[model samples]
Target: MLLEIAIGDAYGAGFEFCGREKIMRSNTLESYVPHELGIQAGCYTDDTQMSIAVAEVLLANSDYSSDAFADAYVRCYKRDQRQGYAKGLQGLLDLCVNGADLRQRISPESRRNGAAMRSVPLGLIADKNVLAQAASEQAMVTHNTAEGILSSHVVALMSHALLYDKAKLVELPDFILEITGFILRGDWAAEVECDALQTLHAVNTALQANRCMSTLLLDCVNFGGDVDSVAAIAMGLASLTPEYVVDIPASLVNGLEAGKFGSSYLRKLDVALAGRYPVLSAHLVRQS
Candidate 1:
């Protein structure tokens, strides 16, 4: 799931700011291409970096800790500040590193998709109930808005469903709708345009068309705003099946920048995670 998140983010990195028409002009997103970051073709953005941080902290502590997660996020940011983080996240990290309490210093107005982008790790590591709590905790570290927190929850739930309910893959659209509807009836009902709802609607529409994995990814990217995060979430959900996992091109995996966490980190994390969870081990073995 983590590897799929990174691969999807990197694959959509080049099209982050491009409109659907612009992407259409390019024909197909067969491989990596340079984007505004001016980095290598398959270099991931802050999405994958923060995700790895979350996974590392969870593995080390064996549970969720907002402070530890915040510290890890700050560490990752300092390691590579140019990973296309939103202005709000950069400011939050700055305050955190300077001794401010992240929970109190967070900007509640920041409803960006960053929270959702790094949430796959939480979903993979926790059970259904714990997943929601951890997703909320980690997301509120920077994005304190209800919409932001809920967006991460939706992604976490989708990831959990993908991992444990592989047989019911076709029911994902209905599940997403039910979840989003419940969210809208809550205290954050005013946040109708939240990223979670938008992404769910997009996914539901795409699934209704019964498109292939490549087309689904490309459509997510071509949706334009917050493309990388949306594509990453879409990719994580799509990767539940062996077919979609194999559909991910080798070039994107090969092109990712080998930073502190080298290319092998994905395989290493997979082994470690599977070892820790027998259910995950079964899922991975079947996928393999």
Candidate 2:
């Protein structure tokens, strides 16, 4: 899940800034290089950066604590602005700087992908209930919309389901549906069930995050409509598979600048966590 989070963070940024025309015209996922898209490689958005913050908190606390997660987030934001921030992210940053309770800052007011983008890491450490709680808390800091919280919860649960069970691979859709049903049943103040279902539909029709690592990885490479969020969710879910660990692709991998701290950190994280990947493989799909 960590490796997927890393690579998805790296690759998803290409689509965040590119229009649909360029996305459709691109021949492969590799074609959307940071430079071609006018962004730099190894420059991840807030999704992966915030995820690392969550991981850091989990690593030290060994338990779920919303305050701890928020503090870690503030620390990261203070350190790096290039963390692929979302709409209204600055307000949350400001609140943190003012020593405000993170809980007070977050409410269901808007449905940005911010919460969902950084949700995978929490799934790695907690069970479904705890994962949902942590995901909610993480987003509550700034994302106040029902859609925002639902997206985060969905990603965390899906990732948790994927990571914890190996034998249930064949029942992926059922699991998604079941979890989706469970979440939608809660009183979230808005009908974000539709939005969550749309994302699930994208994952199902375009990127199958449950069947195989290769399937989900390839799906992420081609999926549109908040591709980073889709890719992040897919990677998070896919990373749960013991066989689906992510490794940097070699061709573009070598071009990564080592001097940049983000690049260096990702490289080290790859070395520590990524699996041995194929040299170069054909993209499974073309941009639509």
Give the number of the best model, judged by TM-score.
1
lDDT of 1 by residue, 1-288 (tens): 667677777777777766557577652666777775574677777888888888777677655756777777878777666656666666767656632365567655666676777887676754667777788778877777887788788777766766766635566546656765532211111211226556545544443343356676766666666667766766666665543534545566677667666557765776777676544665456334
Worst 10 residues of 2 by lDDT: 279-288
> Each model's TM-score?
0.82, 0.73
- The models' CA-based lDDT, in order, is 0.65, 0.55
- Deviation from native of the Cα of residue 175 in model 2, angstroms: 2.2
lDDT of 1 at 144: 73
Q: Residue 219 deviation, candidate 1, in Å?
A: 1.9
Misplaced by over 4 Å in model 2 are 35-38, 91-108, 167-170, 179-197, 209-218, 242-248, 255-264, 267-288
Model 1 clash pairs? none
Superposed Cα deviation of residue 256, candidate 1 (Å): 2.4
**Candidate 2 per-residue lDDT over residues 1-288, each given as its tens digit:** 444565565666666545557556652545225635445764556767777787666656555566677787777777765645555665667566632454566554656666776776665643577777787777766565677777777766665665555424445656756776632221122211214445544544433333454445445545554566556566655555544434445533444335444556654543433222111011111100
The TM-score, computed over Cα atoms with residue i paired to residue i, of candidate 2 is 0.73
